[model samples]
Target: MKPIEITDIDVSYGAKKILEAITFHADAGEILGIVGPNGSGKTTLLKAMTRIVARDNGEIRLDDRDLDSLGHRELARRVAVVPQDISIGFDYSVRDVVMMGRHPYIGRFASETARDVEICDHAMHLANVAALAGASVHDISGGERQRVLIARALAQEPTILLLDEATSNLDVSHQVEILNIIRDLAGEITVVSVFHDLNLAAYYCDRLLLLKDRKVYAAGAPGAVLTRENIREIFGMEMLVKPHPLTGKPYVLPVYMHQSSAGANRRVHVVCGGGTGSDILHLLHAAGFTVTCGVLNVLDTDYGTAMHLGLPCVAEPPFHGITPESLSGLRKCLESADAVIVTAMPIGKGNLDNLRVLLDYPAKPVLFYARDHSTRMEDCTGGEAGAVLANLEARGALRVEGAEELLARLSRDGSDRD
Candidate 1:
């Protein structure tokens, strides 16, 4: 059975309408996530579905029953909501907070029974906040308080759980813990959670509902909903989406704006590490300059980032030790480039001579970022190759400090060619 259903729902706050005919359904034993940017009405939608916010149009049903017809007691027994903004105004104990979820079941003006205490205890344990049961709720951390709230919701014994940015304040490990708990509970109860973290949503949710500007932008499995186009359109940023290696889930990598080559008939060879050179390649391309790179290990973050960006790269197998063949190939790749920029990367024995090869082609201009000579020299195979740089600089190797400077120089070079 569909656990919760919304049909043509429209919600407004005072004079302003927030939701635009939002329609979706959550099935029994399934996990779904609602995601969007700030002020996108994710929380508003949850509130409307839970009857916390009045809906002006459309209908909502819980397990085939009209939601509006349910009384406060009946509604609380059927659906529970954990809001995004969790703030405590009173100094209630953790157990006191959780015990409140039993309000619908208790008789009017009656004290808690033994069963209520047992359920509250189990709920606290389930949320992993049992140790804080006696402590004041307001004194706990955000993550801990969030857990307490979830425990309170669980204590409601509802079949449908609606969570709004439930793990926003949790650390990495706690985030995983809370998500795992929700995932484990999906089979017995229906879950519809709001998540701002795209990676976390993609990893945990069986389906995704993307809301943009208070309307449904997309809805489907993560593979379909979290595409490059959807992300760029909704988030207003360019991103590359790839399947995670271990989980086969979609992962987003933001694409920073880059420059293009303008007038350069010349190409520049960039020795980069840690994906830092990817932007430089784009800049050169924008200025109409060609770029090439080499001796990077295939698994290196920079190498992969470059490869995905479609840069001409000569990459070696990771950690296999750069061999004569790899070095030769690297040199060949840079043969046509007019200049070379050595990015800040640790120089190690395995790939030490990668920089040394530049000395053979002294005719090409070399540029390095203005940095401490001692550190740069140390990375050049224990300073054995540092003298080459010193001699070249003494002769004339330009040092550039910023992207604009490099682009300006390339622009001048381009103008000269014209």
Candidate 2:
């Protein structure tokens, strides 16, 4: 397969520019993913490469040959695109639809040769649509139809395949199956797919190009392109980008606003560590509380969540015990907060100071998620942390059994203050 080079490409609808000074190249035998929010020209860019959308300026070249120089048939022989939407008004068998890809190879009046049939068969098998070959294209499910369309593209024998949000309508399982097939095909054919699922793109694509505001926002490996800051800038949404546990690829989890308005003017300070604080922090922020969290280690999961939400956090170095400076910072946060909540995380010497400081701030309304006291004390420092927690409870700290109850209590308290 040949590499695709797009240089200084500009596309405009009349006087309105859709893409400006766009430049990128998809390497041979690699999957290059294009991602951006709606109206960012992801589909427009794919259409430009296939000449479905004419570029007002710049050049698109496959290998060294210019796209404009190639005839329609010649371009179809080299580049095949699976459009975002496919409609079959007339009833056509899946096999018949797939055979259409051979038009470039077979002359206008010529019949399909044995080799053409074999190529179409192989394409169907590769796309896992061989069993559905006799079915009507309109009778099958959307996922099945999608595979059939991909089979048709494969049968085109193109050096480059362009997928314009092909998996957008697929369910999770179907999405995985389709993307896996594309990933495998990348070993031999160049693939350029536009994706809405950032996690899937990060996992499958060899490289990614993020488009924003009519230009390339960031382009590189997933780790370099899918940062929290980049998503916030391009999508105007809060997201947490972390490593996938199984693949070690970038995983994106969107932070949604669960509540529409601020429930109260009260501030809440949360004491948490390990990964325990993530849910509490999210709920507090979504509930419209001015939330602060501390003293999380710099690399902890909770710290990442806190940073993603733009919450002020007191952080210490990773793998280090909490220092006096961090404790002092926590105390200041407690002083300003109307209430404090702690998640159920195992307590160790490194963070036992969290419990100690909460005990000192007895005047503030303190809540402890003590759903499983034994589990929380499993890592207690010689039971010292457990004893401190017990002392805090005795000093009027409220204990909640679960997140639902905690949120309920918080909502009730916010209403009471109002």
Candidate 3:
């Protein structure tokens, strides 16, 4: 059975409707993230689960038990919440605040036992707040206070943990630390968190429930749910969704670029690899050019960049040499292109055809793009690649340095958009 399930949930704030027709389930021992824009009812959903806000209509079950069927103390023993930056009006020590998590288990007339103290101490250590146990919560930094809240939640030892932007106050380093701690506990404790940062959600959450306008927009794995179209549709903004370097998970990169029609009708095919054409692809695509790239290996960074920009690319399999089919595809891209730009990527036998093929397009305007003076094409093919490059340059292959100059020259060439 799912650890938590909410079906057809509706919530309202007074007469104002907040959430509608929300349905999702969190698997046991998994981290499920609830993410969306402001006023999207993320916080309200959490409150509904905790009974802090009444659900207008829905069924919420915790481990097969109806949420309403559980008593207050029993519910506390089953669930815990780590909220954003809560204020401690009274001067309670970190230990005291964390110890409060154990109150659900203690008898009404009884005091804390040795085992309760042990649980609190272990929780503090797990949260990296052991050293601050004796410090007043008010005296600690905002980030430290947040960690104490995590320790408190851990002390509860609840089967399900809910977080409302719990790490919003922590710096990147501390945020990672806390997330790592939480992720380590995934197989033991089921977590449902409200995440503001899409990248973090992509990296951490096993499954995501995306809300748009207070309704369930998408629900699935991070890779499937955080598509470029979904982000554009939900947030009304365009973002590049690609694999992160460290984790290989989908990472969201906002396109902080303005669109122009300067190259509106222009098509430019880029010949690049080894990350040499990443920015060039982005630059050309942003400048409103219909860009195509290739002869790139599927595993190449430039290939990744081209895919991110939604450019039609000619790609070969990893470690595979240029195939006849891909070369034919490359020829098609060049034949219809107004211009071709080749970056200063390495030249080896596997990709030597990428440069040699340029000789066939003598009439096409060609630019040998160098991102900087220090990085030029290295001929690894015993001078054959260099000779081909020399031939292209001889046939008027202009060498353009830097993004601005390349853009300027392409703008001039691509003015005939028709």
- Per-residue lDDT over 309-378 for candidate 2, one digit per residue giving the tens place of the 0 to 100 score: 8899999998999899988999999999988998888888888888888777767788887545453645
Model 1 stretches astray by more than 4 angstroms: 244-248, 256-267, 271-303, 307-338, 342-363, 368-418
- By lDDT, the better pick of 1 and 3 is 3
- The whole-model lDDT of each prediction reads 0.81, 0.88, 0.91
Ranking by lDDT: 3, 2, 1
Candidate 2, which segments miss by more than 4 Å at Cα? Answer: 258-265, 310-326, 348-350, 370-387, 401-418
* Per-residue lDDT value at 352 in model 3: 92
For candidate 3, give the lDDT.
0.91
- Kindly list the per-residue Cα lDDT of model 1 for residues 79-195, writing each as its tens digit: 887775477888999999999999999989898999999999998998899999999987888878888888999999989998888888779888898888888888888999999
Q: Is candidate 1 or candidate 2 better by lDDT?
A: 2
Model 3 stretches with alpha carbons more than 4 Å out = 1-3, 63-65, 69-74, 104-116, 242-248, 255-257, 315-332, 357-363, 414-418
43-79 in candidate 3: lDDT tens per residue?
9999999999998998999988999999999999999
Models 1 onward score TM values of: 0.75, 0.87, 0.86
TM-score of 3: 0.86
Please give the distance, in angstroms, between residue 289's alpha carbon in candidate 1 and its true position after superposition.
6.0
